[model samples]
Target: MQAAGPGSNTARPRNAAACVQVRLDDLIAQRIAARSLVLAASRKVSAAQAGVKASRFRGRGVDYVESRGYQPGDDIRSMDWRVTARSGRPHTKVFQEERERSVLLVIDHAASMRFGTRVCFKSVQAARAAALIAWSAIRGGDRVGALGFGSGVTGEVRPAGGPRGVLHCLRALADWDTLARVERESGPAPLSQALERARRLARPGSLVVLLTDGFSSDAAAEAPLARLAGHGDVRLLLMTDALELAAPPRGRYAVALGGVRRWLEFDAAAADTQWTDAFRHRRELLLQQARRLGVAHIAVDTRDDLSRCLAPLGLALATRRSYV
Candidate 1:
C-alpha cells in the first residue's frame, strides 16, 4: 500500500470494534479538549464575551486590562484617573469580562460502562467526554478537577488551572479506570461519599458536571444528585445507549447459543412495560430535578457528534452576565 502523506487518516485494525476505541476516544477528545464536557454545564451558567484567558487565581475584585490611550467614542467612565494623573495620557482601562469559576466532573467507570453496542462503550465515551470538558473548562479560565466514581470516589485530581491541571484530571479518570475496582460484596460506593466530595470541593458558584450511564444498581441516585445540585451549578450529562432510549428490538438480535454463535430464543417485547416506562420516566425525572434546582440537564447518546452536541451549550453559556 502507498504510504499516505501528512494529515491523512490512518486505517486502523478493522477487526476489533465497530469503531476503534482510540479513534473514538481521540475523536471525542478533540471535539471539546478545552470546552467539551463543560459546554453543557457552561450553558446552564454564564459565559464571557470572548475566548477567556486561562487563570486559576480568581480575583476577589475584577482585574482591569492595560489602560490604553482613550480612543474615539471611548466611554468616559473607563477613563483611569491614576493613569491620567501619572502619564497625562487619556487612558481607559478595560475590566476583565469573565469571572473565574471552578468545574468538577464526577465520572463512573464500572464494569457496566464497558457495555456499548455502538461506536464506543459508556466507559470509553465517558472518558472522552470528561477529557473534552476538562479542556473546555480550562479554556474558559476555570479551575477544573475530577473524581473517578464507582462504588465510591476512587481517584481525585485536585482542582487547578491550565492544561496540566486538566490532564491531571483526565489521567485521574483514565488511568484510574484500570487501577480502581469495587467488590460485588461491597456493592457500589454509597453515592453519598461522591456527593460529599463534590459539596466540600465546590463553592456556591462553581460548576459541577456528572457523566454517568445512570445505571447504578443502588437504590436511588436522586439523593446525591440533589445534594450536589445544591452546592453549585450542577449539570447531569446522562450518557446512555440507544437501546435504553428505544423500545427493545421487536424480534431478536443475535445471541450466543450454547458455545457457538447461533440463533437463540429471544423475546424483544419481554421487558416489562412498567420497567421500560420507569426507565424513561427516571431519565426525565432527573432532568426535571436538575432544572428545578437550577442545574443544567442534557442527554447525549454514545453515537452522537461530540462537537455539535456541545454547540447549543456554547450558545447557552454566551448569555451570562459576568459576576464582576
Candidate 2:
C-alpha cells in the first residue's frame, strides 16, 4: 500500500488530537466487524462435543494426559522414552485436546506509537487491532486477555471467556492509550520487560499476539520472545505510520509537538535516505527475529483498513472457506 503523506486525504485529520486518541466506543464497535473473523480452523464435529475440537491445523497437541502403549498409528515424535525404558515396552504420550484456547494480546503504547502521519496514531491503530482480535477470539469460544505496557505503567487483564473477557481487554487498551498520551515525555518501558511479563501470564498452548511499532524492541527482547514462542503460538503485528515507511517530499514544513508548533527542514538527498534506511533497518530486525522464532509477522500500516490487515490472521487460523 502507498504511504499517506502530506496533503493526502488519508493523512492526519484536521482535528488530529481527537482523531489520534483511541475511544472506548470505537473499540467496542469492533465486535460487529469481528463477526466475520474465524479465529481457528476446525472440522465440524458432533454438536454435543465439549470444548474446542482437536484440529490438525494446530499441528501441536496440548495438555499431556498420560502414557499408553504405543499404537501402530501413534506419532513417533510423541514417544515416551522414560516410560518405555521402565516398562520395557514402547509407549507414547497422550494429550487431551485443549478445551478453550487463551489468546493474550500484548499491546505496546510506547511514545513512538503516539505519532502518526496518517488517519490515526500507531497506538490508536494498535488498540483497534487488539479489539478486533479480542472480539474474534471470544466469538470462537476462546478466552481473551491483554497486557498494555508503556512508560511508567502497565495494565493487565487475565484471560476470561465470553464478552466479559473482551470488554476487559478493550478497557485496558483504551486506558493505556490515554496514559501514553499524557505521559509522552517519560519515554517507553522496555519491550523486554513486557514480553517477560507476557511469558509469565500466558498458559501453555495459548496464542500470544503482540501489537507494537517495534521502536523499543531490541536484542534484549529475543530471549523472552523465543521462550514464549517455545510454549505457545506467537504472532507479531508491527504497527507503522506513513511517515515511518516513507519520507515526505523534501521541503521545510511546520509541525506540532506537544502542542508546540515548530518548523523542520527535510532534504531528499541526505535526510530522506537516512530516515528511510533507519525505518527499513528496524523493520528488517523485527522481521528477522520473527523468522528466527518461526512465528507469524504482520505489518499493519496506519492508513490500511483493519479488516483487510487482519485477513491473513484469519486465513492462518483456518481454512479459506471458514471465513464467516
Candidate 3:
C-alpha cells in the first residue's frame, strides 16, 4: 500500500497567492508613529504646493520671463529668433526653469532581499527608507505614490499631496513585509512591471525614486533602468546586503537539487573578490548612472539602522524655507 501520495504540491498555494497585497496598514501605522522623525505628524497641506514637493527642484516652470539685448559673447543658441523678428533688435528670450514636480517611488522586493547580515534584510531597509521619503515628500507638499515590485506583484497607491495620504503610504510601506508573507506566495513583483507602471503613471518632470538591489541580470540592469530615464527626474538608491558585498570568512557550500550537483565553492576570506566583485562593480556603475541622470545615488546596507541613509535624504529636504 505504498502509493505515492500527493506529489509535493506545496508550491501551488504559495504561487497562487503571489500577487495578493495583504494590507499591513495597522502595523505600518504603528511603526511610523514609533520610528518616523517627522515633527508635525498630523499637519495637513492647504495650498496645492504647500507640503514638501519635488517641483521645487524643477526650479520655476518654464515661461517667457523676459528679453535681454543680445551680447556679442552670447551663444548663438541663446538667440531668440522669434524675438529678433518681433523687434528689430537682437534679443535673447529667457525662459523660466521648471520648479514644480511630483516624486514617485518604485520599490523592489525580490526574494534576494530576504538575505542580509547586519540589522535587517534588503527589503526591510528599502521599506524604511521609502517611508521616510514618503513622509518627507508629503511635508514638502509634493504628491507621492509607490509601486512595490518583486516575484510578480505590484502594490500601488495613488499620489497624495497632504498629510493623510502620506500617513497612509507610510503605514503601507512599514508593514509591507508582513503583508507580502500573507498575501504573496511568490516573491515580489517583477521589476519590469513596477517600472513600467511607474513610467506610465508619473507625470513629466516628476522625480522617480527607484529603490532596488540592482540585482537585475538583464544586460547590466541598464536597459530596464534606461526605460525610466526619459520619464522624468530619476533617483536610484541601490539597497544592498553586507554579505552580498563583503561576505563572511571561509565558508564552503554545495548547491544541490536532489541528485543534481549545482555549485561548490570554498573561499579563505569572507570578502572574496571573485565572488563579490560583481556586486561591487555594479554599485560603482549604479552611482555613475545616477550621476548621469542627475539622480541621487545612495548605497544602503540592510544591516545598519536605515536612519543612517534616510536621515541624509531627509536632510536634503530639511530646509524650512526650502519647504515653502
* Number of the predicted model whose TM-score against the real structure is largest: 2
Clashes of 2: 0
Task: List the lowest-lDDT window of 10 residues for candidate 2.
Answer: 41-50
Error of 1 at 102 (Å): 0.8
CA displacement after TM-score superposition, residue 134 of candidate 1 (Å): 1.4
Tell me the number of clashing residue pairs for each predicted model.
8, 0, 27
Compute the lDDT for candidate 3: 0.57
**Which candidate, 1 or 3, would have the higher TM-score against the true structure?**
1
lDDT of 2 by residue, 70-135 (tens): 989777998999999999999998775545778899998777777777677787778888988988
What is the alpha-carbon lDDT of model 2 when measured against the actual structure? Answer: 0.77
Cα shift from native, residue 147, model 2 (Å): 0.3
**In candidate 1, what are the lDDT values of residues 1-324, reduced to their tens digit?**
011112211122244442323233453345334433344332222324323554433442355667788888777877898988999878977665445677888877655565555555666566666666667776667788887767444677778877778766766665666454333324555445666667777766677778766654233556666776555567677887655565545555465633577653336455546546766764565565566667665676666665555555566556543333
What does candidate 3's lDDT look like per residue over 1-324, in tens digits?
011112221111122122122233422433343344442222222332322454434343344667789876665766888879898899975665433446688877666665555444566557656666665566555777877766544677777666677666666564565555445444335455566678777776566788888664233345545666665556677887656776546766565654797754556554477668867674566565556555666777654444445555554433322222
Ranking of all predicted structures according to lDDT, beginning with the best and ending with the worst: 2, 1, 3
